[model samples]
Target: MSASLSVGARDLPRTAARRVADGLALAAAPTFALMAILVGAGGSDVGQMLCAGEQGLQIGGMTVMYMLMSVFHLTPWLRLIQSGKREAA
Candidate 1:
């Protein structure tokens, strides 16, 4: 029907937006985790090498920032897991 088609057309953008948001939610955790791992492992030496001429730059800052980002991004994953548990129960 024309009315159904119109409704579906209106929902198309909303559905696309939801999918995009879900994709970002799924992507954020692993992206931040990888960043944190890389920064925590050998970031100090890499930072020193990169900023050889800079003064008083703390390499730990980047590691901490990435760690915080990873922590913050875990919320989406936690919510996802909670939803899964709810469905199972």
Candidate 2:
């Protein structure tokens, strides 16, 4: 039925959006975990590298990666919020 087809058509984007959010969550989780570990456990190493005039590129890279993933993961949630559509129960 066209009505049913229309229903499904409308749902497709939301399904895709949810899937995208889920995927981003997976990627963001490990990124933040690694970031916490690097910052917390590797603090001394990072500090030493900085004090020694080294660029500490690894730490900087991790920070950048973490921020990027967090932003990506947050995007779906922001869109969902802005759309004013309540998630299906």
Q: Give the root-mean-square deviation of each candidate in angstroms.
A: 5.2, 7.1
On residues 1-89, what C-alpha lDDT tens digit does candidate 2 reach at each position?
99999999999999999989687765675667567556644555756776887653344566666756666666556665666665543
Model 2: pairs clashing at backbone N, Cα or C within 3 Å: none
lDDT of 2: 0.67
Per-candidate TM vs. native?
0.75, 0.44
TM-score top scorer: 1
What residue runs in model 2 are displaced by over 4 Å at the alpha carbon? 41-89
**Once superposed on the true structure, which residue ranges of model 1 sit more than 4 Å away at CA?**
46-59
What overall lDDT goes with each candidate model? 0.80, 0.67
